[model samples]
Target: MGSEVHECHLVCGPPAAGKTRYARVLADRLGACLLDSDQVTERLVRAGLLLAGRDPDDRDSVAYKEAYREPVYETLFELAREHLPRGPVIIVGPFTREGGEPDGLAGLEGKVGQNVIAHFVWCDPDERKRRIEMRGETRDLPKLADWDGYLTSCREDRPCWPHRFVDTT
Candidate 1:
């Protein structure tokens, strides 16, 4: 007997929104594989490569961004496509409201040819800060007037995908 197949679900949201945890649990529930962006980025970082978090405005940042971020997303979609013939896959990451654009995700979907679902996890700003602090990530702790504004812009500019807002606070 053949196992049931499911569509790939892209789990996205702001920083510290529990995308990883939720993706793991969802994958388990659906008998799918979970692809985490942080793990991918950390692996690159460990290999002496800096991803987007290093220097956002630097021109050379493009190299790291393409090398790390692009592959992660591409491989994830490729894996999802490969599994589409068999089952489902769950992609967990910020897909940051600022960085992840509809065109890119659409391109991925076009490659896969349908069978994709995007979900966003939304959390209150204070709760997000607490979660970040809990995880010991202090450097990017939404501080300074400009930083706060940027975050707000990112959140507001986030594309409207089929999403589910989860309150972790």
Candidate 2:
């Protein structure tokens, strides 16, 4: 993988599934450019939420999903395209929609104009919940408060698309 160049890697999973940590190590090993959606979009997204009279840490709201998620992903892919010519690029995000099927993964390849490799990270549900609570990020307050509802929404199953499974548990 280290020798591979001009390719894009999508590292995805539910929150607290260790996507960013895995991507960082993988990027170092592959000598790839690393892009994290949170790092790229958090400040602006928080500001937007505040301006919209929503909680700045409200990442799970429909308002955030509808208004901010798409643009954040687009920016990540756009940045990936810019960095790809230099070497490999690794993008880390939840990517719930994009990791669900073959077409979605193909669409991502088209965006970067390069072969795209997808990695879906997961863990035992209990472990995930524990990690979420332990991290204590304000953004996770809603999820922690509604553990059962949040668990119902999280996908522990491997994606329908061809990809690697990273078990952080």
Candidate 3:
């Protein structure tokens, strides 16, 4: 995969699935550009431009997700478009919902017409719960209280894109 030129590798999974850590290692190993939603959103929030909710800093809020999630995803993919031509890129995020198919990558494929590799990270439910709790972020709602129901919500997920899967724990 390293020898492949101008590739875009999208590393996807739910929050706390270890996609960020895995992609960080992979990007360094491959010397690829890494574009991540959390990093980008953090920047936006720091800039005081991404409140999207009643609580300006509460990511767990529905209004925040409604306003920022897709926009963040779009920004990361656009950043990938700029970097991918020179080398490979790893974009890490929960870009897709827990139980949904991968859509066209913000329509980046047709525009760039380049190879876009995809991989999804998976972790054991118990371990994932532990990790999320350890992180203790504001975004862990919905899952923090009812992990079993969250699991059910994502039970039917199957990505439309053909890809590989990695177990993070």
TM-score list, all predictions: 0.71, 0.93, 0.77
lDDT of 1: 0.63
Q: Looking at model 2, which ten-residue stretch has the lowest summed lDDT?
A: 1-10
List per-candidate RMSD values in Å.
Answer: 4.6, 2.8, 4.1
Clash pairs of candidate 1? none
Name the lDDT value of residue 146 in candidate 3. 78
Worst 10 residues of 3 by lDDT: 46-55
Candidate number achieving the greatest TM-score relative to the actual structure: 2
lDDT of each: 0.63, 0.87, 0.70
What is the C-alpha RMSD, rounded to one decimal, of candidate 2?
2.8
Candidate 1 per-residue C-alpha lDDT over 32-131 given as tens digits, one digit per residue, 9 for 90 to 100 = 8777766645555534443434543221234655666666666766766677767778877666632355475676567666756777777777776667
lDDT by residue (1-169, candidate 3, tens digit) is 2344577887877667798899999899999988887887686753453343354445544666776777777787678777776788887777566225455553445544566677888787788889989988765765777778777654324356676788877
Look at candidate 2 and give me any clashing residue pairs.
none
| Predicted structure with the largest lDDT when compared to the true one | 2
Best-to-worst ranking by lDDT:
2, 3, 1
- Over the stretch 1-169, how does candidate 2's per-residue lDDT look in tens digits? 3444586899989999889889999999999999999999999998988898999988887888899989999999899988887888999998887766658888888887777899998888788889988988899999989999988877666767889999999
Give the poorly placed runs of model 3, Cα more than 4 Å off.
1-5, 46-53, 56-62, 97-99, 102-108, 111-113, 154-156
Tell me the deviation in Å of residue 143 in model 2: 0.3
Model 3 global lDDT (CA atoms, 0 to 1): 0.70
